[model samples]
Target: MRRMLKQSALVRDNNFKGGLKEYAKEMGKIGKFATQLKIAGYVSIATDIVGSSIKVYEAAPEDKARTTVVETAKVGAGIGFGIYASYLIVGLATGGTGLIVIGIVAAGAAIAAKGTSEIAGYGAGYIYDKVESINE
Candidate 1:
């Protein structure tokens, strides 16, 4: 057991709780709403590709401090999407046409949102990584 452990260079405690805890903080004052997530390699790549155009609006000094805009936007979107999905369900009563249209729109919106959000999220992560690297 000791030989195997030594050969593998295994540490007793393998708690990879992330090294850069406050990556978002490194890019401070980025706007009214700011947030970050501990994403994986694939996400970072995706973010890099799509975040090329999306500009991150930073907060001005004169503006009063408030809750993070990123978090607020995500939460609001989540809630909004939920409601929107529910609309499709309720609209089923209107008629087959209404249901069909709503269904099609909802499906398209969901797919687009999924891709857009991923790219946006990756953009945020990419920014954080770059900021942190520069700071270091």
Candidate 2:
């Protein structure tokens, strides 16, 4: 029984050392790939924003163009804040350095921010319309 225990211990030590080295190498590769993914994510966001801006410009009437611009600005600000805040919170919670993980969190936060921005914009527009009508 004592000899069996010693053999098992040696086996465990050998396997653990080899496993840790391989795991470290794989983690380094994942980190590099995640960084590339993060860059692609940001590029995609920029293109989406630009494409949406162009569509808004084409669809909005000459008079309401300014309103559209303002609403777009508000949405942009909301998304920016949402992403930043989410990154901070998630980073603190998980202590993660993986770009892909943070990117996923940011994406979800951005979607939530979009819904919030739309609601706020609608309310602001309604209030503006009511005030203008009252003034006239």
Candidate 3:
């Protein structure tokens, strides 16, 4: 059955609400790593953004998925920044030795979250592609 096959993708975890929650958290984790690497001058922010943009447009809706991606990215970014803002602020306030590092970490994490969302969208596009391809 088509519905049964679709359910297969979920494996041990299958629920729309559960999926979204996992997606957002995964994005956040990816973002955190991205920030740390970017701060070390080991990565390009532009590259990540470009990749995400492409994904957004791939399976895009009538209004363009980029819009949705951006909106969702913003929400994700906001959550990331919120989680770290206080630490960054206090570090700066105390004249910490590495506020720059803190900032980079925060920024990277925010962007990473966006990129993760992009990746998720890309997966969705993959499924669409498969359906469009068909064996017949």
Best by TM-score: 2
Decreasing TM-score order of the candidates: 2, 1, 3
Candidate 2, TM-score vs. the true structure?
0.50
Worst 10 residues of 3 by lDDT: 8-17
Model 1 earns a TM-score of 0.32
Error of 3 at 132 (Å): 5.4
TM-score of predicted structure 3: 0.29
By lDDT, the better pick of 2 and 3 is 2
Model 1 ranges with Cα > 4 A deviation: 1-97
Clashing pairs in 1: 30-58, 31-59, 33-68, 33-69, 33-70, 34-69, 47-122
lDDT of 2 at 8: 47
TM-score of each: 0.32, 0.50, 0.29
lDDT of 3 by residue, 13-84 (tens): 432234545544644554565465445432444555565566557744864644555544644444455446
Q: Candidate 1 vs. truth: CA RMSD?
A: 23.3
- Residue-wise C-alpha lDDT for candidate 2, range 1-136, written one tens digit per residue: 5456344433245333444454345456656755765675577567657765776667748536547654665566666766676556455334424446655666676667666767766776677777777988
The predicted structure with the larger TM-score, 2 or 3, is 2
Worst 10 residues of 2 by lDDT: 9-18
Error at 20, model 2, angstroms? 6.7
lDDT value, residue 95 of candidate 2: 46
